[model samples]
Target: MSRIHKFVKDLAETRKTPKEIKTMVDTAFEVNSISQSQIYRISALVMAGRTLQTRRARTEKEGPYRRLY
Candidate 1:
């Protein structure tokens, strides 16, 4: 991942207010964009995200399934 991505991902794994999160993005990108609002929205989603562990999709539709299978 890019440094920026890694930093955001790490932040997402923990807790932070909008101000601190904004500071992080500012330090990494060091520039403003027309899509600045979108960036903030994405950052908020990432910040409230679950564990960074990768998840795979399952096609089966069975009940009480277990990965042990």
Candidate 2:
């Protein structure tokens, strides 16, 4: 998972306010700002038990392994 994703997931799970989450994300990423909607969307996914995937994982190729009977 991306560090940013993990950070957001942690804070969201802990019930931190969305504003706090956004502030932390901006500081950690060294960005001028991040949109509140993005934070809300990510937090919703985290609360729903969805795992965040990094870019590499998103494009990684799968190996062919046949299942054993």
Candidate 3:
């Protein structure tokens, strides 16, 4: 699974709050070299039940396989 998907799934399984998720995401970005925008998009996907492909297409112009948030 994608990092975003894994992060969201973990958050859901752990019942993390948005604030907590945001903090975790921020830390993850700093450590993993991921973009903040991607993280935000991923969070949106998790919350809205949107497909990752759609979000990726909207967020980037390159391969959808790349990590998004």
Candidate 3, residue 63: the lDDT equals 57
Error of 3 at 49 (Å): 1.1
Q: Write the per-residue lDDT of candidate 3 for residues 1-69, one digit (tens) a residue.
A: 667557755674466665676678667765644454555555666678766677656668665556634
Q: How does model 1 score by TM-score? A: 0.39
Candidate 2 lDDT, 16-66, residue by residue in tens: 888999888888889755578868877876776765564235435443443
Q: lDDT at 53 for candidate 1?
A: 35
Tell me each candidate's TM-score. Answer: 0.39, 0.58, 0.41
- By TM-score, the candidates rank as 2, 3, 1
Q: Give the Cα lDDT of each candidate.
A: 0.51, 0.72, 0.62
Name model 1 segments beyond 4 Å from true: 33-69
- Lowest-scoring 10 consecutive residues by lDDT in candidate 1? 50-59
Please give the distance, in angstroms, between residue 21's alpha carbon in candidate 3 and its true position after superposition.
3.5
Candidate 2 has what TM-score?
Answer: 0.58
Rank candidates, lDDT, best first: 2, 3, 1
